[model samples]
Target: MTTAYWCVLIAIFLPYLATGAAKFFGAGYGPQANSDPRAFLAGLQGWRRRANNAQQNAFEVTPAFAAAVLIAHQVGVAEQLLLDQLAVAFVVSRLLYFVCYLADWGPLRSLVWAFGMAMIVALFVVSA
Candidate 1:
């Protein structure tokens, strides 16, 4: 219902998108297609790995967002700037992170990862 919620939802989806794209283009590097679920899943392992990254990112950000929201609500800081910024940071960092992960960007990926965590911390601090 809120921007933060939407950001989390987008975060939840990005990895799946990245994974699907990887599977689509990963023809030569994977298993032969077959009716077997195991074979089909094997063909999409690269996509699954990317999806794992997305899952991890979701796991990292969701708790922070929920905690920030609850803290803001309890502390009467519901309209705080940090909450909004957290959403922005979560979205931007996630987008960059997915790009970096998929494109094999090295150190820059770590920087984006740090930025996202810092944003979550900032939100927590402001809410507290």
Candidate 2:
């Protein structure tokens, strides 16, 4: 598989990373949490709450990224390396975004979010 394809796979699971952090750091996951995970996560505050937000954002953004990569591949962009690089950058930006969210670095998080979206746009442009 191409590097970009691998990145799509990584993006698929990235939200779980943020959620895992929230669960591990905020409080231990228990039966109640397992029963109603959203309710349990909703009760979180501070960094944990931010982590949940990040996870939700990750879920929101991942679909576009995955679609961009797939569409790029289907359309068969000439710059395969460029597509891979952008995919990697998107993943890196997402990691940084998660850190910013957890650390409450609002401005930087927003910038990283923008960067990730730019990468997605670039992917589509390359496909075009």
On lDDT, the leading prediction is 2
Summarize candidate 1's per-residue lDDT along 1-128 as a digit string, tens digits.
Answer: 66766676776676556556544555543444434534454445554555446545656666765666556556765564557667777778878887787666768888998888887777667766
CA lDDT of each candidate?
0.64, 0.94
The TM-score of candidate 2 is: 0.97
lDDT of 1: 0.64
Candidate 1, TM-score vs. the true structure?
A: 0.67
Residues 7-123, model 2: lDDT tens digits: 999999999999998887755688878898899899888999999999999999999999999999999999899999999999999999999999999999999999999999999
Worst-scoring 10-residue span by lDDT in model 2: 24-33
**Model 2 CA deviation exceeding 4 Å by range:** none
Judged by TM-score, which candidate is best? 2
